[model samples]
Each structure stands twice: as C-alpha cells, then as structure tokens.
Target: MLITPDISTLSYKRQLAKRFDRASRSYDSYADFQKIVLDRLLAMLPLSQADVVLDLGTGTGQALGILSQQLKPKCNIALDLSPQMLTVARERFSALPNLHCVCADAERLPFQEKSCDLVFSSLAVQWCLSPLDLFNELFRVTKPGGYVVFSTLSQGSMPEISQAWVGLDSQRHVHDYMAQDALLDCIKASGLNLLSSQLSDILMWFDSPEAAIYSLKKVGASLIAGDAHSSVSPTRWKAFLREYEKQRDERGVPLSYQVSFIVAQRPAIV
Candidate 1:
C-alpha cells in the first residue's frame, strides 16, 4: 500500500516545492557546498555498481553525471519535489536515454517494493516532515540486500544564524536540524540494518553576511522557523546584520553545517 501523508504535510510539501522551483535556475550556481556533501555521501556507497539507482532530491541533477559515469547503473532515476528542478535535470541528462526524472515526495515513494538496488540521497531527507516515514519508504523500495546512503544536516548547523537571531527576535530564523541520536533511532526503527554513520562539521566562508545567508536561499534551504508572512523592520534587519558581523574573522563570515553521513542496507534473505 502507498503511504498517505496528512493534508498539512501535503500543503507544506507544496510550499517547499514552489520555493525550490524558484531556485531551480540558480541552484547549480550556488550549490558548491551541496556538491561537497554529495561527494562525501556518494563515497559511502556500499556497492561499486548497481542495476537500478534512485537519486532522491536531485536538485538540478548534480549527482546524475557522477552516478551515470562511475556507478554505471542500468537505469538511473532522478527524483525531486520541484517540477522546475526536474525539468533542469531532464534537459541536462537528455542525451542519456537511461536517466529518468520523477517529481515525487520522499515520504511516499512511488516505486514498487524492492525495486531499487541503490537509494541515494544527499542533504535531502532532513526536509521531510517525518524522518521515520522517510526511512520507511526508503526501506520499502530498496531491494533486499541493497544499500541506502544519505547525508543530512544535524543539530548545531548554522550556528551563526541561530546565534544572530537570539536577541533580535523571539522567532527562529534558521532551520532546526534533528539530533544525530534521533536520526539513528529512526533508522533502526525503519528496520534497515545500519552499516555505518559519521558526523562531521563543515564550515563555509562567505565575503559578507548577505552572501552567507544568500547561499542558503540560492539552494532553496532557507526555511525559517517563524511566521513566513511577518515583515522585518529596517531596525531589526540592521540589528541582525550587526549581530552576524560579530562572528566574522580573517577568512570571512562563516556558515557551519553539522553533517551526518549514513549507510544502511536491507538484510538479505538467508
């Protein structure tokens, strides 16, 4: 049976899709950090090659080239929430007849049971409303003995943004990443055998505070925690900048990401 998300979850995903659609054109340009994370995630794959591979949340199809060239999957599926992003991916991989683009929700994968040999996602699972549901779908679709490799932001990500908004406003201005322990628990609960997991801190340097924040939005990742419709006053904006500037150092303004690299697999039948 297909998983059915509640009404609110569906609405939230639509909003996320629209925001990402707007960022589709600019996503590749500002996705340097994403590429870094993707590379690390790909390096954790358990198999050298697979018959079928699914690239979840493949924004602008960055991983398509590497997956197709190196892993050489017979069929490569590039999936995302944004239609525009899928369009870009389709155009980029138009020459590759085996590459297919699908717009779908991660929590409710459209694939049949035990269909994919490799389910890979980079910096994407964190966006789902329920990590358990996301992993359940991953577990369901992955062929027995197949692997699932992914990278997601964990707690302590974007410390600068969280700190800067401390006194300026009561609302949260940054995304609240899930704790590593909770994520691990979800993986276990989903019945996927955990192979290995690692946590690392990645820091990016930007010329200024504006550039640092722009990096998030350009990638369609700047989902704030407060009221979306609330307007920020000039004074508050200035205060936020002032607070953020205090963290600048010799290199430039800093944005931190606490990344969790995970590898899991479905147990093979005896």
Candidate 2:
C-alpha cells in the first residue's frame, strides 16, 4: 500500500539531509560517537534466523555492516534519504553481497508490507517529519511477531544551548524531540505493542560551545526546522556564550540529551 506522507512531519528530516549531505565529506571523523551508540543499540536487539532487517536511514552502510555481522540477516535493505550519504554507504559495503542501499523517505517506505522480520532505526527517526506516520509505516512492513527497535532524543536534548540561546538571543537552533510519554503514545497509536522502553537522561561534554555546534553540524543535525542562517550579531553571540556557560558542569559544557530506546513487537496476527 502506498502511503502519502504529510510534509510537516518530514520538515526536520529535509533540513538534516542538507546538513548531512554537506557534512558527508567530513562525517567519518565524528562518526565514532554514532558507532558507539549503534553498538549500544545492537546489544539490545535479538535477531531471528535469516530474518530480513530493514535499516532505515542507514548512513554510510556502517549500520548495515554491523547488523550483518551481528544478526547475519539473509538480506539487508539499507535505505537513506540523502544520495551523498547512500553513496558513502554503498562504497563502504560494496563487498557485502547481503547489503543493498536505496535512497527513499522513511515515512513512505518503498517496501513490501509485512515482509520484514525487524525494522531497526537509530538516531534517524528523531528527524522524521511525521514520526507518527513513520512508525505506522514501520508497523506496516514488520511481520507478525516481528520487532521494531529505535532510539531518538527526547525533549531535553540540547537544553544547555537552547536555554542560553533564548536568553542571549531569540534564535532557536536545536530541533525539538518528542517527549518520552508522547513518543510512547505515538508508538502505541501506530499499533506496535510495546515490549520494553528505556528513557535515559544522557549528557555529552564538549570543550567549547563552538566545538559543540561544529559537532552538531558535522553530524548533519544543525537544521532545526526554521534555523537556516542565524545571523547573530557579535553582541548576541557573546551573550549566548555567557548564558550557555551557565549550564556547564565541572568537566565542561554539557549537551543534555534525553534518549529513549524502544523494543516493541508486531502482533503475530497482523
């Protein structure tokens, strides 16, 4: 069944694609953090025998490689929205016969319904223009008794910078993540019966605010719906830095991220 997606839900994803497409040339340097997160996510998943796994937003094929080695799925479809990102993924996984890269939207997935045993998405779904619709699409493709595992930042993500920015200036650069309770509600509404979910408050320390912003851009995360080119005056930047510094911990400035991990199952009858 073809699903027509609402553009509002994919607005952030379009912005992030621009960010990632621009950063693809330099993404490898900062991808280690993503790898760590991927490892943590993988440890939580349990795969069935030769099960087909759909890796949504599989940037650079690293996630596919990891899944292939760990889950040994019979076939892996690595789908990403950015052509540049998929190019990187295709190059990296060229030798892996099991992995195939396709450029497609996550919300309106171009795959057979109820054909996949598992649908795994990482940091990607947070950027879904319409998370509810995306989850619904995920539920559509997953076979009965199949699993859906995903991770995304919560509302508290980047509080230090967001709070400071509001005080220093009215510019909002951080994207708004779904709240834990709200996100769970969306998942449930999509018909994926929740098995378990863990919402954790995580913080990432950075040497400087510029470094933090740079890392965000490097990871293709700078596009916060309306944040195009924030032309802040020097005075505003200074004020912003001062407010941001207030949120610093003993180690250094902290980027607050409330992360949620979910493991849900599609009903066997569905």
Candidate 3:
C-alpha cells in the first residue's frame, strides 16, 4: 500500500532540512547505499554531452566529480535544500570552473525555464512534500529534449525497521516511501516522457540493530519522518531489537532498501 504524507506542513519541511543540515558533517561516512544507487543510476544514462547540467540535491557533491568526468557539461549547478550541505559541496568542488552551488528547494527551482540540458537527482526527491511538484519543477527547467535522471526510495524500503516497529506503539519510526506506481504516475503527469525505470533491492548489513540505527543516524536519515518527539520505552526498544535480529544473516543484521531508477525526457518542439 502507498502511504501519503502531510508534506504540505511547513514544520515538516523545516524539520527535514534541519535534520539534513545537522547531519552534513557525518553524511558521507554512512552513505554507502546512496553511492551504490548513484553508480547504478549513472550507468543507466546514455553517454552524451550536455551544455548545462543541474544536480538537484547534490549532497556533499558526491556526484559532482563523476558527473564532471562523464558528461563534461560546460556548466554544472549543484543545488540542495540544506545550506550546510551546499556549503560542503561548494568547498568540495570549489576548484572546478563553472561549478555553481545553490541552496534551494527542489520543488521551487530558481532557474529560468528550458535553461538546463540535464537534471540529475539522487535519493533526494522523497523528502519533498510533493513528488509531482518536484517533477514539474524539473520538467520546467529542462530544455526541450533535455533529460532528467534520478533515483529514489520506493515502497517496501527498510522493511526490517518498519517490521520492528509493528508491534510497538503507533508512533512512526520510519518514513514512508512512495509506491512504484505512484512515482511512475507522477512522472507521466509532469509532461515528461518516461524512457525507462527499474526497481531493485539494496541491502546493507550491520553488526547489530544498534549499529544499523547508528549508521542511519550518522547519515541524518534516522529522523526523516520528522517525529522528533517520538521515543521507545526500554521494554519496547528491547522488543524491537529482538524483532530486528530475526532478519539477521551470516553477513549481519540486514537493512533492505527498495530503490527506483528513472529516466525521462522533455520532448523537443517541432
């Protein structure tokens, strides 16, 4: 089942940004899954040159170097909702010519229409209150016949964590991921032609549930649901850990992520 969030709340949006800002310093250390998905997303793109490219939600500028090496666009714009993240990206790519770092929301791009030839985002749009709004923004900024390539979490991600909280209280511990069908629908609704999309499961193992939680916290993804006040009692926490351990394998405790990779194009006008 697909879960829709009340992303319209300003407080929720602020909470999301603040959590990411606080996590800026430690994000790169625990972003292994993100890196894996990004590599796969990059592989799916057709080899071509773009005059101008926009890297939306360019966390820590992780994709900057590779994008620069591959697309070799004349200009690369790295944008993010978190100022601290942008700060880190700017410093990381400061020496690269024509690289601009902008602190801006993905849903409301600060660029002229049809200006960019390529738009790339990784594991970022899920945080937006409205995926449709984000897609629309991407479509608007993209030049006719331009491309938008992205990867995001889909439904059934982190089932181990969600399952652990099943018997616990009603408070939400994990953020809800968008259903695959819903995501495809949003892409179609944005007036972009879908080229291809694929869904896959990515798993990460930890020594224990605590280690998994720690990794997530380090990446600032733990508080993604914006449930700042939610807490688990000692008894409940113990039960949750016990439940999570049931999914352990020879590698370690498993954290599963369902990721969706999508490629779309803005049709060129005749």
Candidate 4:
C-alpha cells in the first residue's frame, strides 16, 4: 500500500503556488532533471498532428516550441497554477501567435469537455493532491481518440534525502510520492486506456547534499508544507548533512528519482 500525504488543503495548495511563483525566474536554470524527463516524455509521444494541444503545468513555456515543431498544433494552451510562472511563460512564448497561457489548477481545469486534442504534462502530476482528480480532468478535456502523456515522480525518488532525515526526528522532511501500483490503480480507475507506461530509476549527481537540496528549491520543488514540519533546527540540519554524506559515491551525492512516464488515450467514438 502506498502512504500518501494529505495535500488537499487550500492553504497547502496556495503555498505550493507561491513557491513556484517565487522560483519562476530561476526555474529554467535549475530544472536540469525536469528537462531530462521532458525530453524523454517528448520522445515517447507518437508522431501525430494535433489541432489543439494543452500543456498542463507548462512552466516557462518550455514545451511550446517543441510541441509546435513536432506536433504542429493549430492552437496551444499552456496552463499553470502559478500566475507568476505563467507570466514568465507568456513572455518566453510571446512570439508564438497560436499560444495561450492560462492560470488554472490542474485538478479543476477551466476548459470545456472534449476541448483538447492532446494533453501533455511533465513532472507535474506528482504535486497534485489527488492524481485521480487530475487524471479525470485530463480525460474529460480530451477529445475522443486524443492522448494524454505525463511524467511523475514515483515512490522511490529522493531516497537519500529521506534516509538522511532518519535518526533525527519522526517528522517528515521530504514529500511523499505515490507508489507505481497506486498510480496505476488511479489511471485505471480514470477510464483512460493505457497505451504505454514505463518506470525509470534516474540518478542525478550533485556536488553535495546541500547542492541537491538547493537545486530542488531553485526549481520550486522543495515545498514541504504537505508532509513536513515547518522548521528544522540547525543541529538537525547538520546531522542530516552528515548522514547524507555517508551515501555519497565517487561522482558525489546521488539523488535517485523513480520516474514514471505514461501515455493514455480516451476511446474513439465507435
């Protein structure tokens, strides 16, 4: 069974949005991991034209150019929870005539049913309070025979960080990720037909444990309001660093990410 955190509170969501908003300026630089996953996710997308494309959590509009180049959508919708992030994304893609950026929640997308021909999200669904709700929204917005491709962090991500927090206090320090089975169950229940799915263990090497944590913060991924206590004492922080050093390899500290990529489609009208 997967133990997930309760991040459904509006306050937590607002905090998360604020964190991303603050990181908007530096997100592109520190999002190396996200860029890698985005490339992999983009490669997995079947080479088919889409008249309308929706990029959920389209941080800084990274996918806009690529989607335009590959899928050649007539219209592109970039939606995000953070207005500041969307502001940056809009600026980044201002030259694109067909691009539209919207500030909206992934769980409650402000789009009509069957309004999109393709829905793509990268490294975004893991932050949702209920992945099922997001999946359902994706399914609802997708046209018949349309596709939904997404990547999310699975249960084994950031094992070293979690390990380092052990022996300190019982309070959680890292966010909880959904187990693969639990995620699959949600996908199955969402009624979208699974076309392809893959799980990968990608290790990102950092110069130090602090650097790894810093990178996460730079990318707006270090939000801990859901499962972690607000404060960590200086002594506890030092202890965590010492514990984290024990797991360092020759390449430096290893941050293991269990990434899941899934491609699903709504059934075509028969």
Candidate 5:
C-alpha cells in the first residue's frame, strides 16, 4: 500500500489540475450525462453506517450530496488535486457538517493507515498512470474487510474521437492510458482480494460531432493535457472536419465511451 514518489513528479497531473480548475465553472454543463453513469454505479454500492469514508476525486461534490444524505459518516474526506474543484465541492456540500475537502493527488493520498471504512471514486482514476498505486493507497486507508470501489474509463472509451484524429498528424497528442490487462495486473499486485471486476461500454449519444468534442473540452476532458498541439491552420481544420465526418454513424456524429467498474475488499483482521 505504499505510493511511489514518481507519480507526483509527472508534470501531467499539475497541468491537468490547472485545466480542471479553469473549467470548473463550466463543469456542470456536461455533467448530466456523467451523472447517469454515476447513478448506475451507486446502485451497486454496499451501503452501511460507516465511521469514516473517503471520496476520491469528488468532482463538484456530486457524490458528497448522496453520501451525506445516506451514510452520514463521522468523517467524509473529499480529496482532489484541483483547488477549484475542491472550491466547488466545498460550496455545494456546505450544509454537510462532517465533510472535509482536501487537495491531494490521486496516486499519493495523504491519510493514516486504516483511517476509512470505505473508499469510493467515480470516473477519476483513469487520470492515473499507476492505477495500482492508487488502489493500494485506497486499501491502506480502509479498515479490514472495508470496500474500495471505483469506476473508470477503459480502452474503448473514446473510439470515435480517436478515429477522427487518424488523418491528422500523429505526435501522440493525448496521454496514453493503461490497458485493462495492466489495470488487473496492478490490482492483483496490490494484494487485495478483488470481489468483482467488470468493464462495460456506455454508448452516450450526442447531437453532433462538434457538440461531443466541445462538451468534453468544456469539462476539461480534452485529450491533450500538458501537450502542445501542432499548429492547427485554417485549412487543416477544414480537412480535419471532413475526415471526422467520414467516420460518422447513421445518426450523424458518433460519440461512444467504454467504462470499467471494480469492487474490492480489504481482508478482515484474523
């Protein structure tokens, strides 16, 4: 359950936090769809009156509202690296007395051992290059037999957007995500008994290609994090649009996403 210092040194996380902070004002605009995915995730949670709970990457405190209404933990820690995100979370959950918001990197959480009875994150760990490191940290913070459940994007999450970039210059504009195989390897290596591992595709239908791309960028979900885009000339924009349209599905622009969900348990103290 030890976190390596290497993850903190990666420059991507800082720039990612900055972009998200700037986009915080507009985050809710594209959040309605994400909420659907989150609702389905919530239906699976094994709820209890836990003494301590940790909500990692609690963006805008959407989950905080539900946690406060349902579990009413003695202490609910909502942690994220983005200051603006924490600001919005704090504002949203102001009425909840037990909740506390802190800015902490996902890969390296700042918590005492066995401090939480449950740990939950939604669509957040995908940002981590070392998902296992974060998973181990989750295990470390949770009490014995506690749950560490999370959901994240899988390899096929953004196929249409990726395919649209095919004709464009290939400079690896987006950050690369680890494959599902690698993710499983990390979880196994963490020494936690995994109760469930499921990956599914949530095919979100958007009105138009521009709308799809714009919404992702508006919520700071753009692929290019901390990377420079090749000069997009006026002509290239036109060509890129044409190439993008070619991959459109029957309704017109196709926006598809695949996701993974996991539920693991910390071994009970013998």
Candidate 6:
C-alpha cells in the first residue's frame, strides 16, 4: 500500500494552491527540468488527432502549444488547482481560440464522463492525496479508447536534500514520494488498461546548493505534504547548505529525481 501523507484536508489543499499560485510568475523561468520531462512525455503519445484533449495540472500551460500543434484537437482544456496559474496560462495562450483554462482538482475533475479524447499530464499527479483516486478520475473523464499519459515523481527523489537535513532535524523535510511498486499497483487497480511505463532518474546540476534548492521553491514544489506552513530557522538553514556542499563533485551541486512515465487507455465498450 502507498503510505501517502495526510494532504486531504481543505486547509492543506488551500496552502498547496497558494504556493503554486505564487510561483506562477517564476515557474517558467525555474522549470528547466519540467520542460525536459514534458518533452519526453509528449514523445510517448501516438501520432493521431482528437476532438478534445485535457491537460491536467497544466501549470503555466507549458505544453499547450505543443499539444495544440501536434494533436490538432478541436478543443484543449487546461486544468489546474491554482487560479493564478490558469490566469497565466490563459494570458500566454490567448491566441489559441480553442484553448480553455479551468481551475480544478485532479482527483475530482470537473469534466463529464467520457468527455475527453486524450488526457495528458506531466510531473503533476504526485501532489494528489491518492494516486488511485487520481487515476480513477482520469479513467472516468477519458472517453472510450482514449489515452491517459502522465509522469510523476517516484520514491528516492531528492536524496541530497534529505541527506543534508539528517542531523539538523528529523521533521520530514522531504516529500514522501510513492514507491514504484505502489504507483504501479494504483494504476492496475484504477481499471485503466496498462500500456507501457518507464522509470528513470533525472539528474539536475546547479552552480551552488542554494540555487539547487531555490529551483524547487520557485516551482512551488518546496512544500512538504503535512508540513507546508513550517519554516526553517536561518541557523539550521545555513547548516543545511554546508552539509549539501559536502555532496558536491565535479558536476557542481546535484539534485536528482526518480520519475515514472505511464501510458494507459480506457477500454472501449463491446
């Protein structure tokens, strides 16, 4: 079973939204890793046209241009939990008349059943309370024979941060990312036909430890599940920087992520 954090509360959800909303302006500039991962996820899609495509957790709508150009969908729906993020998306893609932006939760999508011909998300669903609930929502909104493609962080992501915080405090500074097996189990249990999945480590190098950590914060990914409101003291924060500096090698400071890419399809009714 996936031991997820207690992120189901309304207050926690609000905090999450606020964080992403505040980061909307800086997200695109600091989201180099996200851009790379989005390209990889897009490559997994088959060359085909669709009437409607849903971009779940479409933060800043980075993939909207590519999805519209490639799929040639009649309508593109960009959904996210942060209203500010959607505002940024709407302004950025104003030229695309077919594009629509909606602020909503991924676990409880606002779309009708069998409404979207394709659903695509990248580096987004892991923030949900439960992967099973998320996948079920995707299966529900996706039309028969339609596809769902997504990429999420897996276990053992950002080890450098955890390693640096080892002695400073044990208050769970890092997010408890789900294990690969647990994530696969959720997909299998969601009733979407498993097509193909891949697990790999995405390593990012930074000039300094502060820059590496700031990258996460600028993308609104710095919040831990249960400890979103806490702040680290300057002393402890400085100590953490020193410890992280010890991890430096020829490639400067390193931050790593274990990412899982998944592709599934809703079965057609006989």
Measured by TM-score, the strongest candidate is 1
**Model 1 segments more than 4 A misplaced:** 1-4, 225-230
| Candidate 3 per-residue lDDT over residues 89-176, each given as its tens digit | 9888889878999887788889999999999999988888788988998999999999999999898888788787786777777788
Cα lDDT tens digits, model 1, 107-216, are 88889999999998999988888899889999999999999999999988988887888977797676778999999999999999999999999999999888887788
Per lDDT, what order, best first? 6, 1, 4, 3, 2, 5
Which residue pairs come into collision in candidate 4? Answer: none
Tens digit of per-residue lDDT, candidate 6, span 13-61:
7888998988999999999999989999999995479899999999999
Best by lDDT: 6
RMSD of 3: 4.0
lDDT scores for all predictions? Answer: 0.88, 0.78, 0.86, 0.87, 0.77, 0.89
Per-residue accuracy of model 2 over 163-268 as CA lDDT, tens digit each: 7777455656677788899999999999999998988776677888777666676767673754433666777777777777777678887776777888998988
Candidate 3, residue 50: the lDDT equals 86
lDDT for model 6, please: 0.89
Q: What tens-digit string does per-residue lDDT give for candidate 4 at 176-216? A: 89999999889889889999999999989999888888778
Model 5 lDDT tens row, 82-173 = 89989998998788888889898877778889888888888888887667777788778888988888888777667776676786867454
Candidate 6 least-lDDT 10 residues? 223-232
- Residue 210, model 1: lDDT of 80
lDDT of 4: 0.87
Error of 1 at 214 (Å): 0.5
Model 6 segments more than 4 A misplaced: 1-8, 226-230
Candidate number with the higher lDDT (2 or 3): 3
